[model samples]
Target: MAAVAGIWLYNKGAQHLVSLAAGALLAMALLRLLPEAQEGLVEQGLSHNSLFVFLLIGLVGFFLLEKLSLFRHNHHHEHDGHDHHHGFDKEEAGRGGWMILVGSGVHNFADGLLIAAAFLTDVRLGWLTAVSIGLHEIMHKLSDFSVLLNAGFTRVRALAYTLACGLMAVLGGVLGFYVLSGFESFVPYVLVVSASSFLYIAVADLIPQINAHKGLRAGLTQAAMLLCGVALVWLLSPAHQHSHSHEMEQHEREEPHALMWSRSVL
Candidate 1:
């Protein structure tokens, strides 16, 4: 519903609005997802080198998939009723249109894993992570809407498909809860993959598209929107996860069985 309303409000200023959404997604990747991934890695006693390697693999994999037409983010410009060639696509869209839904499903699933991992680690951390994920997902879903429309999908169909894909997060969350409950070792690796997905989308798909607007005012607007995106993610993130962890630990000491039971439910 938020995505529908946001799309309606911004349809008139599609380019600027898309740029803003791109900026926000990038910020969410860098400011929120990456940091959380790193923290998860550290907690799991994983090497920083391993995290970087996985991140690189994820980015490269996404790029290669798009290149091979296994996945894509549709970007289109139209003059009159006909479509104009854009950075990503130049002719008719491919038959592998299901790629968008697949991509979105994968992304949302990773988000669920990250959220569940954070919660399993600590309650306040989980709460902040869930809130941040929710905020980022609104813009992400809006982008998905634009992608589908550009690919010649009707708005209703696009919304229906996107909503279905969005529920992948719920599926992922349930899986993450059960799986991570048994195998905490998977958390760090999953978080790293989550971070990589966001980073790849932001840098590979969004930044270049926004850069297409070369006017001075447009440049300034994009810059401001990008910064705002980063700022929002940073602000919403907890000040210090370590501090939250310490508090959780103290609480656990004061009420060991209760904290254990809560953790188990997560």
Candidate 2:
């Protein structure tokens, strides 16, 4: 549904959509993924700084990936005797599209693990986590759809690709349910790596494209759209969970007592 909406919006104005995608990707990486990874690292008694190391490695790895993509594209075009202009060409766009999909898949997979973990702890918490994740997923999917379109993907292909990435969540959930204790330790690192992909795509690809257009009105419009994208994620953030933390704690406290009473009767 989000992808369909993105297709509709793409027909309206793809450039603005790119700006919005940029904002959403950046916010997801910086505002949500990194902080969550940091907290998890701290909980594990590991240095949160290690997250940065993984982040740096991811960025460099993606950079190399893009360079390889560009090289292959240029080589293929050269053999075909076709000349392509520089700056946000088809190759760059395609690279960005693939990178975003990869990042989104990893992020979604992590979300599934988290939701599964929550469910294991408490069903109500699991449902709440799923709801929040669904909302967040919608926002990112819309943004990702736009990027795929901008990368020259046909609407059908873009939708199909996005859905494929979305399915990774189910795979993650299954793995998490079966081996959460062993895998939970790695989720933080996965998040940090996933965040790096978003950061690289937003900064290296999308922002430059947004900056290519010149005009006070265009600049203002782009800025507004970017902020709107960030605002959407902020509004749907899980910060509200903190307010209910005490309630969850109280319920947990009562669970053992209830279990004891039932045992006594038995």
Candidate 3:
């Protein structure tokens, strides 16, 4: 559906509309859906530590998945006829790509279910969780886009694919809403599973690739981005999850002043 829409509507006008819709979709997911997920868990009487533990598990799982994928097999071919970092193992990446898609799809679907369950408990929790999910989604989209474009997809096709992946959130959310009726019984495990998959993909796959591209200088930038991503999620966390607030605030207070450099008059 995304490819059809983007490919057929490949004009500047359509681009504008699509981009606008993209932003709105992300905003709704972040500002609306996430907090609700948290609320749902709280209502189920799960402890804050348990929730964090699930999130931790989520991150570690993705990290491990990436590690396992490192031993992946491949043979030489041009991705979409483009020369990328791995000129030797195109077939391997292709196989790995399918695996990534499957894992990522499962993760995304779970995200949808978790978000709906959150909102069912309370709107505020839904909102916060949605925001956190949106950040991860944006990152996921960018990485996936890179893969698609490398695989010979035109820019239009890539965007469409990314968009389609994103729209799956809605489908997942709908299924969660209906299937989870009185089945709000299992949100803790669901959240744990959901968070772990996301963390794994980000930590194990994306971060390593990003870090691989770095020089000595890239290390600082990578470190900053990691902290920033974590901080942003911590910020949007429900009040009960404010365990990291003191550390974050202390860092905020210690920041050097006059950070912005303007054009030198000298």
lDDT winner among the candidates? 2
Q: What is the TM-score of each candidate against the true structure?
A: 0.68, 0.57, 0.53
Residue-wise C-alpha lDDT for candidate 2, range 1-266, written one tens digit per residue: 44455445544776777777777767767877778778888899989688888889989987886675531111211222223345648987788778778877876776677667655544544554455455435545766776677778897898999888788888988888778656777767666765776688678767876898999999999999899777765665555455467789999999999999999999
Candidate 1, residues 1-266: lDDT per residue as tens digits?
A: 44564456555665655555565566555665566677877777877777788889888887886676444543333211335365646334433235667887886776788778777766655665665565446656776776666667787997888888878888888889998999977766666665666677667766776888798999999888777766655565565555677899888788978878899999
How much is the lDDT of residue 224 in candidate 3?
54
- Model 1 misplaced regions, further than 4 Å: 14-23, 68-70, 75-103, 121-155, 240-266
Q: List candidate 3 segments past 4 Å from native.
A: 1-81, 84-106, 213-216, 240-266
Residue 208 local lDDT, model 2: 74
lDDT of 3 by residue, 136-204 (tens): 454455555556666555677667656766677788999888877677677546655644544444444
* Prediction 1 TM-score vs. true: 0.68
Most TM-score-accurate candidate: 1
How many residue-pair clashes does candidate 3 contain?
23
Taking every candidate in turn, the Cα RMSD to the unseen true structure, in Å, is 9.4, 10.0, 12.5
- When sorted by TM-score, best at the front, the candidate numbers are 1, 2, 3
List candidate 2 segments past 4 Å from native.
1-3, 70-182, 240-266
RMSD, candidate 3, Å: 12.5
* Winner by TM-score between candidate 3 and candidate 2: 2
- Lowest summed lDDT window (length 10), candidate 2: 71-80
